[model samples]
Target: MIRIVIVDDEVFVRAGFSALLSLADDIEVVGQAGDGAEALSVVRQTVPDVVLMDVNMAPRNGLEATLQIVKLPEAPRVLIMTSASPDNTAWQAFATGAHGFMHKAATPAQIIGAIRMVAVGGTATTPEVMKRLIDENNLRNPRHVAQARSRIDLLSGRHRDIILLVGRGYPNARIARELSMSENTVKSYVSRALEKLGVDNRTQAALLVRDSGLLDETLANESRVL
Candidate 1:
C-alpha cells in the first residue's frame, strides 16, 4: 500500500483530501495535520511514503516545512499543492526536494496518480510547471535559446556586454570595475536591461544572457571590429 499523510492549514481541505484518498484501495491515509509543525510531528510518527502538503499554511508554511522534513532519516516524498499556478514557488518547491507540484484544483485522478508516482520515488509535475522549472534553471531548450537571443539582440551593444558579465556571475561592483564605470551606473544599466528584457530580476536576465549564446556572438563581432 502507498501510505500517505495529508497536511493543510484548513481542516476541511485535509478532510477532503483524506476522503479522496480513501477511494483508492491501494492507498492509505496514515495521518493528517493542520500546519507545518503538526505535519512534521505526524510525519515522524507515521513515516508515510508520501506527503500531500499544502503550500500556504501559516506560522510554518509548506516550503519551510519541506526543507526541514527532507533531512530526516528516510524522509517521505513531499508533493506540494498550491492554490494557484506554480510560478517561482514551483522552483522553490523543487529546491526543497519536493517530489511533486500540482495546483489544488487537480482532479481526484490526477491527485491520486501524483501521490502514487511520488510514493515510488518519481517526480510528479504538470507540463506547465515543468516548463517553468526548465526556464527558471536556465536549461537551454533550442526554442528558448532562440527567443532569448532575439530579446538580447534588441539590447544596445553596451547593454549586451554588461548582461554578458552578469551571466558570468559578476556583481554590480565587479561589473563597474571591469567596465570602468561607477557602481551606481552599473546598477542603472542592469535595471534598464532588465526592463527592456521584460524580466523581474537579475537572475532571470542572467539566465537569458546565458541561453541566448550572446557572449560568443558579441566577442566575435568585437574581435572583427578591432
Candidate 2:
C-alpha cells in the first residue's frame, strides 16, 4: 500500500482528500494535519510514503516545512498542493526537492495519480507549472543565477538552443518542428543537454536555463557586437 499524509490548513481539505484517497485500494491515508508545524509531527509518527502539503499555513508555511521535511533521513516524497498562483510556488517546490506541485483544484484522479507517481520516485508537474518554474527562476538570487548560467555554459551551442526551448516548456515534437530537426535528433540533444547541466529531469534543466538568464545575456552580447 502507498501510505500518505495530507497536510493543509483547512480541515475540510484534509478530510476531503483523505476520504477521496481512501477509495483507492492501493492508497492509505495514514495521517492528516491542519498546519505545517503539525504536519512535521504527523509525518514523524507515520513515516508515510508521500506527503501532500499545502503551500500556505500559519506559524510555519509549507515551503519552510518542506525545507525541513526533505532533510529527514529516509524522507517521504513531498507533493505540494497549492491554492495560490503556481508561478511563484512551483519553483520553490522543486528547488526545495519536493517531488511535485498540483493546484488544489486538480481533480481527484490527478491528485491520486500524482501521489502514486511520486511514491515511486517519479515527478509529477503540469506543463503550466513547468513554465511557471522557469519564469520565476528569474526572481531568484544573483548567486543562484550565476551558478545556473555557469552550468549551462558547459553545453554546445545546439544543446543550449534545445535547453532554452525546454526552459519554455516545449515538448520534444514541438521543439523538433520549430528547430527543423527530427524528433529523434531532438531527443539525443535533450539527453546530452540534461547530462551537461547535471539535472535529473527536464524541469530542473529548464529552471537552470531560466536562472542562468541565458536569453537575456545572449541578447545583450549580440546587441553589443552590432
Best by TM-score: 2
- Provide the lDDT at 97 for model 1: 63
lDDT for position 154 in model 1: 76
Candidate 1 lDDT trough over 10 residues, lowest sum: 199-208
- The sequence of per-residue lDDT tens digits that candidate 1 reaches over residues 52-137 is 99999888999999988877887888899999778788867866767688988888999998887666544677777767765665
Count of clashing residue pairs in every prediction: 0, 0
For residues 46-86, could you state the per-residue lDDT of candidate 2 as single tens digits? 99999999998999999888888876776898999998778
Report per-prediction Cα RMSD to one decimal: 14.4, 7.4
**Candidate 1, lDDT over the whole model:** 0.81
TM-score of 2: 0.65
Which residue pairs in candidate 1 have backbone atoms (N, alpha carbon, C) closer than 3 angstroms, thus clashing?
A: none
Return the TM-score for each candidate structure: 0.61, 0.65
